[model samples]
Target chain A: MEKFKKNERVVALIKILSDNPNQVITLNRFSELLNAAKSTISEDISAARKIIECLALGEIETIPGALGGVKYKPILTLEQSLEFLKRLCTELKDPSRIIPGSFIYMSDVLGNADQVATIGRIFASCFKEKNADYIVTIETKGITPAIMTARAMNIPLVIARTGNRVTEGTTISVNYVSGSKKIQTMSVSKRSIKEGSKVILIDDFMKAGSTIKGLKDLMSEFKAEVVGTGVIMSTAEPDHKVIDDYVSLLILNDVDETSKTISIIPGIK
Target chain B: MEKFKKNERVVALIKILSDNPNQVITLNRFSELLNAAKSTISEDISAARKIIECLALGEIETIPGALGGVKYKPILTLEQSLEFLKRLCTELKDPSRIIPGSFIYMSDVLGNADQVATIGRIFASCFKEKNADYIVTIETKGITPAIMTARAMNIPLVIARTGNRVTEGTTISVNYVSGSKKIQTMSVSKRSIKEGSKVILIDDFMKAGSTIKGLKDLMSEFKAEVVGTGVIMSTAEPDHKVIDDYVSLLILNDVDETSKTISIIPGIK
Candidate 1:
């Protein structure tokens, strides 16, 4: 095996930990992989942690038990989170984003991979302690951020289908009222989630929280617990939603189709 | 700005470059961000690249000239790709995954974030040279891998809806035959993809190639060229498909419903 210097070990450590966020990596494995000593690996981790903290590049946690070693937590600082949301608000406030039906043309924002991953990291930071077993979202627009959140949190992403598809095999479904007041059905594979598992419900946008409520109802069928709920954006109207106690990154306060202007602000202060 | 040691600098460089894959980061930007001299940052990058190559993490390319800079490409070497695929095949071979309709229950596999990211990295390695402007896929299953692939390539992900949703503004719809011989409609927002841009179509499964064909048709309406098509898995019985040029990670050779057995092998030699 080839010997690695401290710089090389640090690089390898950061890459491996970043790739598998929130998952523990034993020191012995790193020692074997890098052909380094445990003490050297420990020192390397301290150096990596310092740079990560100094640069605000998430958190590197060390678990001190026999089963513990090190793990990367995608926790963004409060300042970083606010800065990102503020920037997102500006991008979303562009006049040209307004469509005929007062809808914001956000396909470009939601479709950008790097941007979505950043949003995912923010969410992961927000609900890091919920200890979620899975991140759940309905199909279509929500999958992008939900999958990213799952990736950041190092968890499985369970996407409920708009309707039960044959490919999913034995799904439990629930009907929910959509933003347009139309009744819609969503379903999840029966085996996708386990009973009594803790889950986080993540959505791209929330209007009345009906979709979140419906997802909650579906989770009940599987006997799973909804530990956290997060939405990238939520409408400000209707003051009271069907379900409260959810974190939203941005608030869509108003949209003027005639003036071609949109008023969006950061949510949750 | 706090000065960083060589080990710390390597850690920060790996974190930043790993976070933004396939995207260029100039030495000046690194110098400003890390509070290091340009020449020092260059050496740090060299150290990072050496360890990355040593561990088969990916490639770090240094582009030359005025617009040149360092970029991280998520290209898994041949050995790594085969190892991942073979392990996936072994996992998929478990008889418990067989559904009543002979459909394999792949929700768990598709929903795994870290594993899916690995698959995305493999796809990125497969299509890295295509220089696609965007990664495109149809709704639901394909979105996970597609978004991950887009993240790996540092590009945008464009998803075509199964049906025209009111949320998406002015979509272009196309009707095509599904694998089960049902005519289905898929649509993409008119402004979602740029006209005359190059795109890569990604799908989770290809059966009879109708879904992939439909997505290609939808891409054509926008005057976008389909530079490459990739599927995680493709069935072998058809022996013929609407499209001939594509890459598949795995081949589903057979599924015996009675025996609850599935035979899947790595595709593309």
Candidate 2:
């Protein structure tokens, strides 16, 4: 095999590590793939680390010993995350986003791939230390960000449906009252989650946190631990929520249909 | 400004291009970022392209002239895609996957971020040439791969809801008969898709292709053109489908409850 230049080897190394975030890749494997010596691969990783951290791109972690290898951590700094959220707040504050019921229409923002990836990175930064085995969310609105968060963390995602369905095989169902005082049923497959696994719950919006509270109850039935929770938006009013420990990306202060004005800010200072 | 080493520069270039797949980044920008000359950045891009294509990782194409720049295309070769599908088939063939009513429980596979990302890469490779404006799906199961596809293509994602909702603002509703011979209402926010836009429809499963057919009809209402369509799996029983042109990654032949075996294969040879 022809020897690859240092620059070429570094590019390939970064591509693989970034593609599979948080997944370890042993130096022996990289050595075989790049056809380079272990010492040379080590040097490449050192250079990659400097480039990543110096640019504030993220982190490049190297685990030592026989089973250890290199992995990419897409952690964002406080300033970087706040800058992203501030831009999001500006875009979301556009008066045209207000609907008739004084609700802000943010479906487009949530559905955009890169935007959600950034949001997921923020959530991943918050909960990556939890050693979560899965990222959980309900169907419909929450799936996008939850999947992204799961992707960033390199974990499986579990979706809870609003109603029980036969397609999922034997399932466990729980009925809980939503924020509006309406009763709703949520169900998950019996085997979707392993018992005693730690999970991070993610969603797009929260009003009174009733749905999340219900989701927590459902997690309990699975014998899973809710290590952390994150939401994109939460209403400013009703400061006290049904769930006590969860992170919200944005705080939606007001939506005036009549005045066509919206007041929103990043959830974290 | 301080200058960086060649290896460090290539690493940064590869990271940004891979992070935003198919999004163009000009040499001038790279030159500015790395504090290097345009010609130096050009050489770096050439080396990166050779390394990427040499390893069969993907493609790094550089467009010439004033407005042209470099972009990463995560296209999978025939051998690469088939190998991935074959591995998936092995995992999915486990007899334990069969639930009652002869349905295979695949939520775990669908929600696995890395798995879906590969599927999306295949779809993106198939449809990236169509100049699609958005990737569309009808909520729930399809959202994961669809969002991933959209991510790979660097486009927006438009999700059609099951019903008209006030939260999305003024909405457009369409009634379409699904694969199960059930009349279903699917709606998209009027502003979700612009008039005369081009889109690609993606879904998790297609039995009779009724849902996809319905989705195509909904696109007609917006005067949008569906440039392409893709599904992760399609039933082999229905040799004839409502939609004629679509790509399926896997063809689900049968789920024999009595035999405790599943007949499945890669969608394409």
Candidate 3:
């Protein structure tokens, strides 16, 4: 019998396992395939586990029953995704977040990596079931997470600009009121969206839900349906309108600069 | 000799290896520590690798050299970061992006998970070197990436809200021009930024750099030093009064809504 080399044995085992996702491949059968001793097979199995773990491509599980074997899981949990966003909100909510009128400063958290991962995951999970054809958001801050989410789902994203421009093609503009009682028009070009598409509305924050409302109105011209909405953080204040079935990772209750105190609550749905 | 349980042995290996990030660990040393046969130690190492990869913590390396040993590189590469962002940006450059004259809709991307990951890695790589004391951005879209970036760097993020609210704290406002004609007053609370601190500016776009300049002026009152600036996307048409060290993941070139052709260039910064 040819003695099995460790590398060769491990590679052979993975090939066999690839044929069976979420199924346990028995150790005994694996040993026979590699024609190696039980201990040698065990070593090879362990090596294979390491390789898979490092890649994050899949998972390995060991079954304890009589016919048990190793299986793999390739999904991320909802809590794990939200935890990343919460961490970002927590760190960003430091005393320095204290700005006049109880408003906190938070641009830094949006630009960081770990936090971005959290935001992307949370939004992805919300839209995963929708099979959204496209992702849409207002320009500027909304672009980061929108782009991140679109890439993850392998969908295209459309950005709505605030003003009209000649270079953008045809135009459609809608008027909306701001929190400051100012009315402004937000626009999306004619050629930007396809007719009869499903869209997921995304924003950094939802104060009055006016901007999202404007976006929804803009989507109407394209005959697009807004499947869902997502936000990283939101104020729990009652005066604001809420987008149905929307998700936010953090809820800001109060932010004070002089006293340097911020009240934050974990967000759900 | 009594043998260590496979799970315990695997966990121990992971602990040791993780503690020595980006460094090589010899197989002999591993065997000695686990007090197991060389074959057993090898098996344990492989098992541990599988778990790490699945968790998305990092990676493992095997060097085929006389002096080479198994090494785990905990760091993720820049190319991987950029690739993720590029994929994200491509999907986001949809014709649906054009709003009114030429604005692109992107709130969805900003709120999604994959986009968050791309934004996180980009900023993490950019500020991976800078010991950023704080992350700063104005309200709205800028907040998403700012929070994510700060979380990746494990730093605090501060946000400056628009308008004056007395309940928050004392604040200062700066006048900046937007749309080249209108004078807009953007405010930052006095206590938001610390004195003589290093801050990285984060924003969603840089059409005119006035928003950034307004933030810079606000930071001046606190005597905060502006370290750098970063954006998820930029037009690159030189709309800004002055441009400094900045980064963008995508560039919107032309949005022909009528023709349904929106031109884009992947971010160079």
Number of the top DockQ candidate: 2
Q: What share of the reference contacts survives in each candidate?
A: 0.85, 0.93, 0.17
Candidate 3: C-alpha RMSD after superposition: 10.1
Q: What is the TM-score of chain A alone in each candidate?
A: 0.98, 0.98, 0.71
lDDT, candidate 1, A1-269, per-residue tens? 87887788888999999988999999999989999899999999998888898888988899998887999997888889999899999998988777788888887888898889989998998899898999999988888899999989989999998877888888898998988888999999988998999999999999889999999999999999999999999999978999988999999999998778899988856
Look at candidate 1 and tell me the lDDT of residue B134. Answer: 92
Candidate 2: give the clashing pairs. none
- What lDDT tens digits, residue by residue, belong to model 3 across residues B39-127? 88777767656655543445677766667668654434566666676676678667666666567766555545435544755676676
Candidate with better TM-score, 2 vs 3:
2
Overall local distance difference test of candidate 3:
0.66
lDDT of 3 at B259: 88
| lDDT (10s digit) by residue, model 2, range A35-138 | 99999999999989999999999999889888999999988888999999999999999999988878899999988999999999999999878999989999
lDDT minimum window of 10 residues, candidate 2 chain B: B173-182
lDDT of every model, 2 decimals:
0.90, 0.92, 0.66
TM-score of 2: 0.98
How does model 1 fare in lDDT? 0.90
- Recovered native contacts in candidate 3, as a fraction? 0.17
